[model samples]
Target: MTVTVRDFRPADAEAWVRVRRAALPYMVTTPGQVLYDLARAHPGRRYRLLVAEEDGEVTGTAQVGLSHDSPVPGQGFCNVYTDPERLGRGAGSLLVARAEEYLAEAGARSVYTWVPDEPADRAFAVKRGYEPRRPAHFLHLDLANGTLPPLRDAPPEVELRSAADFADDPRPLFEADAEATADEPSDTPAELADYDDWLATTWHRPGFDRALTSVVLVDGEVAAFSAATTDGLTRYGTAMTGTRRAFRGRGLAKLAKNDSLHRARAAGYTDAYTGNDAGNDPMLAVNTWFGYTVCATEVRHVRTLV
Candidate 1:
């Protein structure tokens, strides 16, 4: 049977989740998430979810898009993942080829993707003209069984709150997030300059558990935060965790994450997952202290398009 690649349809949500989970279990996602992301994607992102099928079965999935938020224009991305059981059917190659063609048509000068940190995966990217850039890791913690650090009281000037508290005005959280993201290590940096876009693509994203998200306030301002999403069953995920520039060395990030993790466990979630750049020592140390161990690693790769 031959493999074919096409734009993802609303009905293909389940199969997309199935293949993504099989290929990258550490990145927790669901059918609803896939649909919400596809439907609500920011217009500037030019996001397209592609699915590869073979003989009526989904063999792989790819997220192809132009990074319009990127500070550098003409940048694109295509992250491809194939089901482990569907290898050697050319699903990955087909997806990448199609993705590249779309990106070029969309005015992209370079494309980026994350390749699993393995010899074969590296070889695959090299064969496709991708050059390794940086490394990142997916981490896991047994939220239901692992012992989380005992909750500690914050200083009188510092207080803990949930993202729900900012329901009327999430701009503060957005400000802190933007500042933190500005300094975050990445192959292609993005500036969260548009508040409306953030509200659509991130703050309002499905499964974003505001009640489980912990925010640290210092002097009545958002100093740090730990945003979260859950499958509403057993898997919990850290969407992002960061502290403001002035609060970097104050251990506020740990305070934010610990509070969120405790809330998640109490909410009946058993598995917690997060990711960090290999060079992000401070964040990695925070995760390590919280019992998160490296579950998987992927290297960022980039290829210039002629």
Candidate 2:
């Protein structure tokens, strides 16, 4: 069967999510997310969602875009995934080739991609001229069966709140998120400077569950938080968990995340997923303490497109 790659149509949302969930089960995705992403994608980013179809059946998908938030220019990413059951059919190769061409035409000097750590996956990327870089792992917690740490009472100087409390005003949450995200480990560093952009992209993301997101306040100031994104179903993913600079060493990260997990279980979410760079020991220990085990690993790879 011949494989063809083309721009994503609204009709392909369901199939796109199906292919992605099959390839990356730990990541939460839904048809709403697929449409929302394409609708709200920034023009500067030149984002494109491409899919490979064989005999009218979607066999692969790729999210190709520039890292518009990064300070450095010409940074691009192509996250490609093929249906596990439909391998060796040239879907992945065609998708990668088309995505790379799109990035090059968009003036990207370098393109990065995530390839699973498995031997064949790594070999596929290396053969396509991608050089391995940092490694990251997805951790899963069986929320319905796993035991979460007992929620601790906040001290007199500290308080815990849900992100929904700031529905009328989310700038503080954005500030806290920006501060925490600045120190995140990544191949392309992001600078979250524009509040309006963050509002449209991060805060308004379709799956964002403000009520399930937990925030820790030190004397009424945002100190740490665990942002959450959920599929309207049973899957829950920790979007980001971090403590501000001054709030470090107080265990606020663990406290906030635990509170979120406990609430998630109560809300009927059965699976919890989070990702961390392999070298981030502090966050890894925190996840381990919560009974999250590594479920998948993906290595970051980069190729010069100039």
Candidate 3:
């Protein structure tokens, strides 16, 4: 029962995705998406995908990289996931050990990871010299059975549109994402100043459903939007929901999320998922109003390499 850690290969895509989907059902993943990430990652990120093999079979995977987009330097991240059935076989540990070594060599001063809130997961992280920080919750909504808020009449100055409507020009959505992401609470603050990189990564992601993403327009300008990502099956996720600084407190974000959820339900997506930082009271309140309940939680853990 020896576990070996090695760099990820193209052939490992399916197993990598399977391990991720099983261990973290809340996050959307696809084989193509996995490979795309490894290939198109920003050069500054120094991204690497590691896999753990047990008796020649893939048992675990880890994504390790620097938070290159963060304004602060030397911020790194490593998230490891293993087949649940293969836990305690040292797969998780081996993958994490190799990831930390890589991060350290890449000039990462501190490494951040998201560990499941479960006792065993938290204990494992603590044993590895990581300290717990803020917690984030993953919420799920039963779109098929749960009743969504009725779509309210759009105000005279407000108009509803889909992300696809701007396919010809998605710069507005990128601008909104940049603004909103800067406000999110995280150990590494991202400076999304590279629109081309965003287009290659976020906008072109496999599960991004442009037609189902709802956007709010105030006087013909982008005000708020609820970006949607789906697995083309039952799972739907709110990729991002935010309102511009000048448009905050006007219920525009609520309007956009409500519209997006309704559209997701109508499009036959049954389960809706979204994550919120514990400190983001306003967005949490909005999701609660939409009947979403917390299904799982993960705590941010950090270890200083310097």
TM-score of each: 0.99, 0.99, 0.98
How far in Å is the alpha carbon of 97 misplaced in model 3?
1.1
Off by over 4 Å in 3: none
- Cα lDDT over the full model 3: 0.93
Per-residue lDDT tens digits for candidate 2, residues 28-59, read 99899889888998888999999999999998
lDDT-sorted candidate list, best first: 2, 1, 3
Task: List model 3 lDDT by residue over 1-306, tens digit each.
Answer: 788999999999999989898899888677888988899899999999999999999989999999999999999999999999999999988888899999999999999999999999999999999999999999999899999989899999999999999999999999999999999888788989999999988888888899999999999999999999888878899999999899999999999999989988988999999999988999999999999999999999999985
Residue 226, candidate 3: Cα error in Å is: 0.6
Clashing pairs in 2: none
For model 3, give the 10-residue run with minimal summed lDDT. 25-34
What stretches of model 2 exceed 4 Å from their correct place?
none
